[model samples]
Target: MTTTTTFDELPSLVGTDLGYTEYVTVTQDRVNLFAEAANDGQWIHTDPERAASGPFGGAIAHGFLTLSLTIPFWTELLEVEGVTAKVNYGLDKVRFINPVRVGSRIRMTATIASVEEVKGGLQINVDQTVEIEGQERPALISRGIHRFYA
Candidate 1:
């Protein structure tokens, strides 16, 4: 479920665990498109035949591709109401902990680590973990920062 919050509600959200998004299956097509768009057609991410013999047993999504999915997955967790704009300020930290092979499913669990009011907006820090289906370790973990303009 998605949680919508207003500027006034920002303070109360500090240290809140927003929870996980719905699972998204990572397909070969998706990996190929990301590789193409990124101009990073590494064999392990595109050529399935070659990749099948390589490490991980099959084509795996690029680390950056997995990181990029964070945005879409984040929207499923929370939305800030009455914001003129919400910008991805940057990520404080990001680590690809596991390979997300094609045909795997992933979802994100988001937690609000911190929130502070700025001049015209709020600086929100979120800790996100992208988990591969049935996996003990998460595919990726990141600390994402956002600026929400009122």
Candidate 2:
């Protein structure tokens, strides 16, 4: 279940399973764009002709591209009200469990693992898993930490 809560209710959100986001297809064009923007034009991520013979069989997305989708997926999972700013503090224990091939779809399921009071704000820790569509093993897992300033 997606959650929308106020800053005042943040404390109660700890340990809640915030549910999954809509599936997003990983496309070759998207991967190529990311590679161009990141200056990481690795054949495995940008050159489909070359990558077709590589291990993954075709170009795959950069791990960081998948990681960057965390924010959009998080938005689908939760929305915090009455916050002037919500900051992405940092991530913890990030792991790319599987390579996301172009044309594959992925989604995320998240849990609010912990919450703590911080100066002028609240610190929230969320455990997130990005699951590949129709696959048993997830594509990625990480702890996303954020600060919501009142």
Candidate 3:
């Protein structure tokens, strides 16, 4: 995990990799729940039997479902102090590089990319990647922007 107190703290983080969280296994039940909540019930994500014969050979998690896990990953990576409000501003570039198969154990690696002063407090840019255990490629890569207000 990495902790930063000011914009200057960001520079120290360049090339530094944060630790991973305990592996969280992706399950069909969780995928189904996400699909139901997000209203994205695509066969590849919700149907196991059908997906077994489909591409990738089995049901895979939805890209957004995997993307949404970034919050939990971030929580484990850093601690924010002296902030009255913290909001997700947006994402810069996001890509689903690899499919997250059901039952796969996944964790995230976070790197502080940059930080700048904003209206309320500061805006931080973080480069985050979600990797599936034992996989050569990451399941997701994204630049996430967040705003912190005092």
Candidate 4:
């Protein structure tokens, strides 16, 4: 985990890797809830029996579900003090390089790519990659942007 004493200390983080988070298991219940909420109940994601006979050999998490995990992953990797508000600005580039299977353990690696002064605060760009244990490639690779204010 990476900790910052204050908001101003964020800018000094440029080009530094913020470190990784502990593995979190991808659960069926979580995937099901995400499917229901996103209205994306694809059989490959929600149907265990059917998916068991299909390509991946079993049910897999929705791509969006993996994307959504970024929130908690980032939170676990970064801690800032003296910040009144933090907003998710957007993502620059996102790629789903691998399918996340249920029961898989995944964690995030965060790197501070850049930091710049914005209207009300600092706009920070983080390069994030979600990797599955023992996997050569990451399940998700993205550039996330966030703004922080005092």
Candidate 5:
């Protein structure tokens, strides 16, 4: 479920854990499209036959492809009631901890680490962890910054 809040309520949400999103399966089609778009057609991410003998044992999604999921995953976790615009300011830090093989399921758990008032808007720093189902380590860990305009 999503945590609903207004622009005025942001300041009170520091340290609040917003919980996890529903699991999403990563597919070979998604990885192939990402490879084409990014011009990063590495064997491990695009060529299934060759990737079967590669390090991760099969074709895997690019780390950036997994990181991009943070956008959709964030929407599933929180909703701001009074905002004219919402912008992904960017990420402060990120680490691709583990491989996300094609067909793996992933989900994210997020926390509001801090909220600060910026000119004409609120700037939020969110801590996010994207975990792979049945896996020990998360696929990605990141600190994402966002700006919400009133």
Candidate 6:
């Protein structure tokens, strides 16, 4: 479920666990597209046949590709009302903890770690974990910094 709130309501969200997003499958085609877009067609991420014999035993999504999915997963978790713009200010301590193999499903759970008033808007610090289906460890984890502008 999405946690929808106005800019005024942001301050109250500190320490709120926003819950998880719906799962998204990582497909070979999606990996290919991301490889093309990122100009990082590494064998393990783009060449399935060759990768099948490589470590992880199959094509895997690029780390950045997995990280990029954070945006959509985040949107599914929270929505800030009355913001003219949203900026992906940055991330801290981002770690690709596990491989997202092609055809694997993944989802994210988020928490609002903090909410601080920034220059002209609000800065939301979120703790995020992207989990691969049926996996013990998460695929990725990070502290995502976002800004909502008036």
On lDDT, the candidate that comes out on top is 5
Candidate 6 clashes between residue pairs 3 or more apart in a chain or in different chains:
none
What TM-score does prediction 2 earn? 0.97
Where does model 2 exceed 4 Å of error? none
> What overall lDDT goes with each candidate model?
0.94, 0.94, 0.86, 0.90, 0.96, 0.95
TM-score of each: 0.97, 0.97, 0.91, 0.96, 0.98, 0.97
User: Cα deviation in Å at residue 140, candidate 4?
Assistant: 0.7
lDDT of 3 by residue, 32-101 (tens): 9999999999999999999999998999999999999998888888766777888888997999999999
lDDT of 5 by residue, 44-149 (tens): 9999999999999999999999999999999999999989999999997899999999999999999999999899999999999999999999999999999999
lDDT score for residue 100 of model 3: 96
10 residues in a row with least lDDT, candidate 3: 2-11
Model 1 lDDT per residue over 1-150, tens place: 998999889889998999889999999999999988999999999999999999799999999999999999988999999889999889978999999999999999999999988889999999999999999999999999989999
lDDT of 4 by residue, 39-127 (tens): 99999999999999999999999988998899988898788788889999999899999999988999999999999999878889999
**Candidate 5 C-alpha RMSD relative to the actual structure:** 0.6
User: What TM value does model 5 have?
Assistant: 0.98
Report the error of model 5 at residue 128, Å.
0.1
| Decoy 6 TM-score against native | 0.97
Q: Model 5: which ten-residue window has the lowest total lDDT?
A: 41-50
lDDT value, candidate 3, whole model? 0.86
What order do you get sorting by lDDT, best first? 5, 6, 2, 1, 4, 3
Across 35-106, the per-residue lDDT of candidate 2 in tens digits comes to 989999999998889999999998889999999999899989999999999999999999999999899999
lDDT at residue 73 of model 5 (Cα atoms)? 98
Q: Which candidate is the best by TM-score?
A: 5
**Which candidate model has the greater TM-score, 1 or 3?**
1
Judged by whole-model lDDT over C-alpha atoms, candidate 6 comes out at 0.95
* Candidate 6 lDDT over residue span 38-133, tens digit each: 999999998989999998999999989999999999999999999999999999999999999999999999999999999999999999999999
What pairs collide in candidate 2? none
Worst 10 residues of 2 by lDDT: 1-10
